[model samples]
Target: MSGSDDQSGLLVLGPLLRYVDETSASVWVETREPATVTVQRGTDSASARTFAVHGHHYALVELDGLQPGTTQAYTVAVDGATVWPEVASPFPAPVIATLERGRPLRLAFGSCRTSVSHDKRGNETHGVDAMRAWALEMAGQVQPADPDDPDLDPSRVPDLVLFLGDQVYADETTDAMRAFIESRRDIDQAPWTELKDYEEYAHLYALAWSDPANRWLLSTVPSAMIFDDHDIRDDWNTSQDWRRKMEATSWWHGRIVAGLASYWVYQHLGNMSPSQRAQDELYAQVLAHEGDDELDFGDLIDAFADRVDQQPQTYRWSYTRDFDTQARLVVVDSRAARQLDPDDRAMLDRDEAAWLDEQLRGDVDHLLVGTSLPFLLARGLHHLEAFSEALAQGAWGDRGARMGEKLRQTVDLEHWGAFQNSFQQLAHQTIDVAAGRRGRAPSTVTFLSGDVHHSYVSEAWPVEPGRHVESTILQAVCSPIRNPLSRNMRFATAVLSYGIAGPVGRLASRSTRVPDPPLDWHYAEGPWFDNNLACLQLDGPSLRMWWVTGEVHDGDHERPRLAKVASYALDADGNPPPREGTVSKLRRRLRPR
Candidate 1:
């Protein structure tokens, strides 16, 4: 379908609005076949010939040179036939809303969602999908809210939505995904039920994004995403030994290549600005190709993914953006860019660390560092992980190291705390920025993250008592927009990580050369085990955040309403009022359900 005619057979997946700036935006889509895809954004328009990746057709149409602070409802066309909006879409018309200069930034962020049936049984098993509820609420499909507790700032709409990671779970496939897999290959083989190639990955992406509620949400709201372990597999790149085990597998090569290559096409391509995308060699190749016949990106992306896996330094996945002196966001690639060598263990390789160091400066009202893994985990968890890392790296001997590696993998002790070197580097850099060593300190230096399948906010200050730190340093985590941790996991998380931090720290230090953490913090709000989505708004010097979940109102499974779980605000002084005194107190009072 192209511009004016019926748009039935042209489009397959999307016209997803991604990467919006003051005067420009990009729309991404998948087509049924090769055709010229065009985006009509009010008066301005842009088009690009669809490029083939494997057997699938796709295009990224960059719409630029538009007015700032403008909101324009847009449409998609393929080969001169208009296909988007689907004649009579139930959702609101999708729009490309550019950022307004000097405006307060409102953003919603969370990670780790599973694509499954959103019916009564699904809601009962997995909790309701928070993103879907939000979308329904935004579209005004939900029932009335509590009059006393009306929606907060009803007029406010987020400018962006940052999906931290695991937008799809390759390892934990849903029944639909498995059925698709079984249709293609034998279900009894290695990597059975797991995604193995670009074609499977494509199906996964389609399933993940095709839900009507979420598809509408994605179309209207610009989003940026990073992949977590589950996006490829559980505990991906957790350690050198983990790598060795996976590399030795017969199916590792195809799995990694497909995972990364699909990630590049489906998730990573839309993350960067137009100028940034123009610099990418693969993207440049697509733009330069000239033909009526489809241009397949199969070989190029395959080789790229393979080479990038072998030599991570050849490509950079981390990205940073500033919002006109209001806030600066650094979305880090914590998974792929790792220094896994035993003696030189680091979560961030040297180059990645250097890039992060440069991005951690002050001057903006807020500094947001987005990572899939939480930087400031609970104190006891932090100490234990650090201790495990030391033990695994041979603090005692080879035999001890072998046992430690097993323990580490079993416990999933692979966050920042596990990589003491990189953890300390970030801690010190953040401390410097908070202490005004970078520039005038921002109001808050916040680490926005997800992966733990719980939502919480922890406030921290320099461990050195006399340090003159002005800015608030906090870790705000909202995980599992759909996936809720099992009851056993909740118990394990609360008991092991919430209490006994003092003993854990002492034991870790005694066992090996474990350096003290740079900051000490307490949970200001929660470790709520709810399927949730969280939003943060920057108002002048104060930053406010709230978490919301889907509530199945009176047996209305298909129409769950958005319900607030928690809310907190950092004052102009960048300090939250007394909330929870200790992590143990949180565990006792707000025990996970």
Candidate 2:
């Protein structure tokens, strides 16, 4: 149903381009009130009536019958009146370019952004937002002479932006979030600075995505997203002990419900293909409802979120998208679909693990695995986490186990390494695929990850001398599109990740009866703490990655330019050897500009 005249107020947040395929696209938007929204592409259009959850109105308009391999400009309207591309828009009109067959895909990805103003104060605190710099660069470029040109221009827009995790921080509430919370409830009361309910989450999203520059970029580029611990709380689902402790709290139920329900509406709902959305129960209800009235989904969504959290097997947040024969993007739900059983802790539950195993098979030239947590952390950190897990499980007797639990929680030693069984299973699967045992091996089996607050590239190798994997096994991490680690933390991370802690951790783990890892890896590029964004290009049999951050120039804080931090190129053979003097050179180059 489309609205006719009689709508009030501009859009509160987006007209974000979500999932896009060859013939269809999904665009999500938020409005100040209940209104029918429409997205128009050339002469084709799609419309949907807004639905209400906690008094906020939203709609996801699905555009179908789009031509493959064509770029079309689009506009958004509310209640029959155009609301987007305001009079004198600084940038070009928003567009959605559908993917074509047999084309190399270029994707940009990053994670961990804090909501703050873009003025001098905010830039000083969090560094200039790399996303804003990227958006500006894209805007400055003239329309490409040939859209399908593979190596056309570095400024040419990417096909999609994969936001791995921590899209918003519920625990580390910004000043704007805190102000909104204080206005509604007593600051001294429970749930204090963090978000308390769906209403607050709605506001937080507005704060995060409302900036005009980033908003326009989001509207034009297709995006896929997943949540990390900070989306609900720091160390969410860290362990059964942590889970029990949180469950006992008065506000934990409301927080989780709000977090998951809001995530479904704002992020996950748009990540699915039309066929996938058709199978969703809640989405089916949305489709069935008729007329112009706002459909209230608060109670239904709350119930759904509660059920999914309690029995994770009932729903799957993970999704796999195949881009013709070029590549396959498998985005895993690392946070929710976890087996926290003390005796058999795993990163993925039984059903989720089986699903991932199936998805790990190969035929395409490149296989991209998107998980919020990095699969292969620095060897030192990996060994330390494994040791901690073993000690927590009483590998060193009862007294050691108690201390281990405390240390685990304190140090946040919870990644793939902490869940030994799941890590080993996935490693074996990856090894098989890389060895061509599962299927035709891809040139690269690259793991795209974020959430560590720093960026780096690592390559894994089988331990045995003669054992060889045909495909390159790599971990590429980009984090904190706006947030940067503190100075002390950065120092510690560099010390540990650069080989100081590996030997010590291995010795400790040996004493604790923790088994050795099947493969060993090292940092090939960086442990840089700059707030940055990374772009990966897969062209034929080669994979290239480059990291860029915003750099202020000539006392101009607001208009920062994009500066390249580093670049790495890997051929079909595997990752190139690290440049001889790269460590010292990169450390100098990456210092805060």
Best by lDDT: 1
* Model 1, C-alpha of 473: deviation from truth (Å): 0.2
Residue 352 lDDT, candidate 2, scale 0-100: 97
Predicted candidate 2 versus true structure: per-residue lDDT over 121-237, tens digit per residue: 999899889888778767763222233543334456788899989889998999989999999999788899988999999989888898878998999999999999999998888
lDDT of 2 at 174: 93
For TM-score, the strongest prediction is 1
lDDT of 1 by residue, 134-227 (tens): 8888877774344345443334678999999999999999999999999999989989888888999999999999988889889989999999
Worst 10 residues of 2 by lDDT: 142-151
Model 2 C-alpha lDDT versus the unseen true structure: 0.86
Error of 2 at 190 (Å): 1.1
Q: Please report, in order, the local distance difference test score of every candidate based on alpha carbons.
A: 0.87, 0.86
Clashes of each: 7, 0
Off by over 4 Å in 2: 1-8, 141-154, 572-578
Residue pairs with colliding backbones in model 2 are none
